[model samples]
Target chain A: MIETDWLWGLLGGLMIGGAAALYLLVNGRVMGASGIIGGLVDGSARDQWAERLAFLAGLVGVPALAVLLIGGAETHLSGNPAVLILGGLLVGLGTRMANGCTSGHGVCGISRLSLRGIVATVFYILVGGIVMVLARHVLGWI
Target chain B: MARSLFSALAGAIFGLGLLVSGMTDTTRVQGWLDVFGDWDPTLAFVMGGALIPMAIAWRVAARRRVAVLGNPLPLTHERVVDAKLVIGSSLFGAGWGLAGLCPGPALASLGWGGWGGLLFLLAMLVGMVAAPAAKARIDRITQAA
Candidate 1:
């Protein structure tokens, strides 16, 4: 089961990329999750509010429907309140500040060879690995 | 209406992809980040696979001035690497390592992720609202320095 996880990841990744392609080719917008939501929250997306809302609706709604039909998917997220709060805050602020997240910078940005996207991806991955080591092994916090 | 519908369809596919890719699983994400410990390379495969279509899309988009729906295609013009990109990405990385979830999975997992997920989402929203102010302060401080 563990050995075959990569296959699932690849298949799913293709779907994700395909989705990005569809959004780009059809709607002419970059399929960036954080940017989409951030624009709405910050009022910068006032002009495209409806479009963003529709995208979010499907993002949240489809999974919800899936849960209803095939049982809930397990997240295995940290149960610690502090971890959740702090992590969530960082994710929100950081993605907004950087102007992209994994999907945006990683999938979409790198594919296009965007320098900013590439740089952001490199920094986050490097920092993420460092944090994982510190938290998981040294501090045993998360 | 057609635009909105297509956007929804794209979102749906993206969400489904997250679920199918096991990206919604925090443990797996954490494992992938766990370089010094037990490492899972599944995420690398996912990234590689996703790059294929997106790279092709960029190529296709390059040849077309407008999208299929008549909207002008997004122009990638920004190229500067600044403090915001580095600092923000680092902070985001720390948070990701701590929680093992990013914006996409954070939202996608909500349907089944229960209270923990909801808490994270709310906190994230609060952070998003606060970001502009934070960015402004950072900019001010950087300029002062």
Candidate 2:
């Protein structure tokens, strides 16, 4: 199963990268998911609201259409409200503060070899792994 | 007009990729991060696969002064590895490990993630709204230290 999973991952990754490539080559912008949505949340994208909204509409709408067409998708998100809320808050605030996330720093940034992108990726992955170990192994909460 | 259209197209493709690649699955994401336990290496392929086209895109972008649509390229010039970067990334990582959802998947998963996903999205928005002030405070404290 893991063997076949890699194929799907790779194919999907190519699509993702292709999208980012198109966004850059045509839209002249890095397709950082957090930055795109963050601009809307913070109202900094007021000047280009249409563009940002369009992007988000697609980001949200496509998945929705897929769910309807192919049946529902499962997230397997934790049921704990505490975990959900805390994680959500941190992801939002932290992405905003750092100006990137997995798509931004991990994919776009690293591909370009941006030092900030590389550093941010390292910190997040390292810290994320540590937290997972502590939460799952030590606390048994997650 | 073209910009918005292209943006939407790109975003749609990205969302599709997330769904198809299983990045929208919390268990898969958590499994990837769970290196100490039963680890999943599927995400590495995703990351590596994503890098290939993007790297080429960067090279193509370098040769062109303007985007295909004639917009000035919005290339980032940020190079500083400041405290905000470190602290913010650490926090984001913690949240990712806890929930197994980052910004993109969190949004993409909303259609099927049900109430839990909605809750996470709402909380994420609130946190995003409050982030600037938090950063300001962190800056002050760091400066003082």
Candidates' TM-scores? 0.97, 0.97
For candidate 1, the per-residue lDDT at A30 reads 94
Fnat per candidate, as a fraction, reads: 0.85, 0.85
lDDT per residue for candidate 2 within B1-105, as digits (tens), equals 998999999999999999989999988889989988899988899999899999999998988968998977766669999999999999999999999999988
In order, the TM-score of chain B in each prediction is 0.96, 0.95
DockQ for each of the predicted structures, in order?
0.87, 0.87
User: What is the per-residue lDDT of model 1 for residues B88-124, given as tens digits with 9 covering 90 to 100?
Assistant: 9998898898999999888888888899999998888
Q: For each candidate, what is the lDDT?
A: 0.91, 0.91
Which portions of model 2 show Cα errors greater than 4 Å?
none
Candidate 1, B87: how far from true, in Å? 0.5
- Candidate 1 backbone collisions, by pair: none
Q: How well does model 1 score by local distance difference test?
A: 0.91
DockQ of 2: 0.87
